[model samples]
Target: MNTNTGDDKSFLNRLSSIVEANLSDEHFGVTELADKLRMNRSSVHRKLKSITNKSVSEFIREIRLQKAKGLLEEGSDNVSEVAYNVGFGSPSYFSKCFHDYFGYPPGEAKNHTKTESDPIELTEEGKTTKTFKQPSRMILVVIAITVLLGAYLVYQKLSGNPSEKSVIVLPFKNLSSEESTQYFADGITEDILTQLAKISDLQVVSRTSSEQFRETALSSPEIAGKMNVNFILEGSIRRQNDNVRISVQFIDARHDRHLWSENYDRQLADIFAIQSDIAKNVAKQLQTILSPEEIKQIEKLHPKNAEAYDKYLMGQYLCLKRDSISIRKGIEYFNQALEIDSTYTLAYSGLADGYYALSFTGYIDRKIGYARAYEMAEKALDMDSTLAEAYAVLGIVSKFGYWKWEEARKYFEKAIEVDPNCMVAHLYYCSFLDIVGEPDKAFEQVNRAIELEPYYHMTFRMKGIILCDEKRYEESNEALKRSYELNKESYYNYSRIFLNYLALNDEAAALEKLRELFALRPEYLEYKNDITPLYESSGINSVLKMFLDARLELGNEDDHFLIPILATKLGMQNEALTYLEKACAEKTRDIPRMIRKPELEVLYSNPRFVALVDTMNLSPYFQKLSE
Candidate 1:
């Protein structure tokens, strides 16, 4: 009755063959392998565990790591190249895994090639047996001692600087039969994530990254490995009438162990209390000490009206969809929430976000959209001064709408100070830094934001835009490609890609991207295909005249600074200076950015341009170039 003999051997043979065939595909994990084997995931898992004494994920990882080690020993490629070749999405993650598994980093693997051995090969009996070259007794003793010392040092280092506490709250499942309640479960998951992020003592993965695993077949360890998180929280929500039920479990993802589990059945009004309780319990279980202010922040509740809160959550759920139609619908839901509770600060903040989205996406008149955003943001802050989102909204409005640089900077700084994990604040501040002639500082802030929300399309798009401005075309295209992969329908990502191609002087690629941009939003067809044709046909002077004519006809106030850049690109030094003076008089936020723009180099030699730079107090930022 030993089932591990015949078919088991065949299964192991097939699995080994598949793994070897796809050894370089980093994404060839348990799910893909299961699909390839034509077996259900659970069945594949059980069979693999029984045969290999390891979970499916662990088996696949070991295969990849072993392949990577072999590649390194061969010395054909550098460590990073080997990492990517072995299907690792990130080289650093690959290096860490390699070091943990092989007792040495890949960088040092080449130097110690004499000690390396071939990886274990699978036999027909479905068992692993290593073959090693025989060595002298003294050599064996020396190797054993070296291994013991390395293990001791690793233990000491791990104990001293314990890894930072991190968690990913997976999207809560809707256990209710009614699919309409899915939004409620999603909102609850996001609220819990937001509460944890406010602690400043934990690295909470952003909703975008966690949402990717909503329907994934990957095991807990696999998800945790990909996200680089130690803990995972998953839950389900069941709602019946006025009573709601939530069951949550906190898991130590690294060890695949459940650390805590709780269930709550409460009236709808007590949902806020339930959320707060869950967050506090998680923090306590993780042994994270929260400051008094952090505790108070977490304990703070929104409006008392359950209906209003539900409406607000619905609004937030729609807002996160990030489309023009969804944004408008979100606005309606926010307004509904406000109608139910006129004094709801979060509702006001949501409304402000909706308006800001409208303005930023060009779905509405910028002036009207931004003015409403400003008003709503002010109201939110007046009601709750500690609201980080409200401050972020105000900062964005000030930066893009009013061009109030100092005020925008202050608001952005205050938002981060209030909530250190606020990704929006970090993103806006990064863009602000870029516009203010501090590309190095801007790069740092964008990277921090990316660390917080790695899968967020807008964050990557902004990174691409910033890199494009810095004239790092190759890096900019890589980021933009990632952003496009996250959400291919986004015109924002496509536009940046277009700009990057243009900067790199790849006219065909730029045109292709421009067409994609136009395809996504046909309203831009005229601007992309028709009005801007003069620049390609004649020169910047012809394009400048056409721009002037269009401005006179359209009367758009934004992007006025582009006129000077066009003039400068045409080699019209006086015209560029004149346009720059006009832009300065208008308090254009883009003025500072011109310092690094190659198009504006002609104007830089002018004393007026230098004076304008000095007047903006941008000399200090430029001075950093030398330092």
Candidate 2:
């Protein structure tokens, strides 16, 4: 016998009211109840607490438990049917809950609801037994069925999730030692990422970031910290011969607890179905709010040509690398895929990515390739503008080609809007904000990108740069170190670490670091500029002249303004005159804005340079630095 305190009774009554109002609709939850009751979210949450003294999740579970118990008692269907009918994504999860809630597995609780919704038709084997006193030929239904069903229905009525935005999909595990099969496992995971990315409400972390943890031994909370997710949808895939076995679990990362987990073993031909099922179940478990458009997008299928689809996935895998060499390889593979199936929108998207990469990597003149890249992206968009990659690359072309800052922002934002989980959009958007001088926003976006892919060196390295710009040099150094430790291959990352050290005025340490950076890239201008501060305070301009010499040899007129400023600061007016003439000849952009530059400190008192500065409309930028 279960007895309730006063608080529990009040909760039961409120739940009963909710059930009466919304017993038919399956989607009702805390958010919905709060809305119907016309109360604030926290207020409704408080009332639910006062009534039942149960957390919303517990109430939901109890409701689900009751439904499962009722169906078993009802005996209208077998165990699988009951599980599905009662909205349990898996019979195994339902049974585990049933066992926990009722002290018996669902199999034992079956056949009890058959005689009536009230009477427990306890089954001896499969059918309900005649009665408590008589062992009839009919099987018996379980007794606890009615109570459980009623409780679950009531729970469903009171709970809701109203926000149709945001999601976090956990990384898929690979259960194979063969590296070849790694691609398939990764393919399945990326496939899920891509599918979920189609949802405008969902955020999907990039597979590069997700895959970094394939070997992580971190706990759920640690993983969540690394991924920066509200919830995690983790799964495992094992491909043996032609069949695949997959198991997925959803965890509330903040709680470090599992919400749901299930395994699926299906034939190769049913792979598409498997992918669809995974996405739907994840959304259901998280109680994700999706618009009708998002729901439809979530259900879209892979290409019909299976072989071509495989090739296209390979192209996607390569293109996702986002480097010069890999982008070309991706282009080759995408072409191979499209040759097999011309209508593959994904392949078109991949090709668009390749051209976009070429433009940015300087493999082609951006001026010439901008329209082509835009055209290719438009084609993919025409076929499917919802593709996150296409949107990201298209956004970049808008930025660099037309200087359409707002339009570029809209596209980048939409790419994230399409999939909040996209690391690319998160990353590039951070840099874009940096360009607009929003260091605070840039700081936030880059940190988010780092959180999404902590183990990925590039993302971490980028976070270090943004952090440095935010004057968080200590934090920036840590990020760069982590990045270097992970990917020991990039010399450029070390150059950055050295720069951060210089910024922090670790001069003794910086001197050695400067040597290291010069060893990595002797041509790096940063090395020459590293010693500028030594003379900047002393008003000596010769301190960093190697940089100016290098710029002069490069024949860039912009160096003219820099040289004259340096010469005047060192009290060398003749040298200043030489460079100022060069600057006036070219009318360099920096020359027009000389007051905005510190390099011109040497020229402040020179009459000729002062007149030149006035002529160049640079007076406004000339205020001397305060001590």
TM-scores of the models, in the order given: 0.59, 0.51
Q: Score candidate 2 by lDDT.
A: 0.57
| Number of clashing pairs per prediction, in order | 1, 33
Residue-wise lDDT of candidate 1 within 1-627, one digit each (tens)?
Answer: 555888889988889889889877755765578789999766887777777666676677777887888888888999899988877767876876676565446886765453332333223331224423211110001111112222222232333333546778899898876665666777777777776666554567898889889998998899999999887888887767766677777777888988666566777555556545544444542233446675556545445566776777777876876655446656666777787789988899998898888776555666677788898999998988999989999999887777677899999999999877788999999988987767888888899889878988878877887887777988989998998889765555665565466668776686677567644432233344543466578844564454343332222334344456545655667877876776566554445554556556555556887787777666665555435
lDDT of 2 by residue, 1-627 (tens): 555677767756776567445533434555555577677545655566665555444565566667667767777778777766654555665665565455335776653332322222212221222322111111001001111211222233234342322335555666754333444455566666655555444445666666667777887788766666655667776666656676776666768877656566666566455545544444543343445575456444456565666666666665665555445555666666677788888788777777776655445555545666787788888987677767887777776565455777898999988766667788878766654446677777777777666567878876776676556888978888888788764554665565456557675564555456444332333334445565456422333354344333333222234466445545667777766755554443323333323345455677877776556433443432221
TM-score of 2: 0.51
The candidate scoring highest on lDDT is: 1
Which consecutive 10 residues in model 1 have the weakest lDDT in total?
135-144
Error of 2 at 336 (Å): 2.7
Model 2 worst lDDT window (10 residues) = 134-143
Give the poorly placed runs of model 1, Cα more than 4 Å off: 1-164, 266-290, 492-502, 505-597, 600-627
Name model 2 segments beyond 4 Å from true: 1-178, 194-208, 219-291, 364-369, 401-407, 413-421, 436-493, 496-506, 516-627
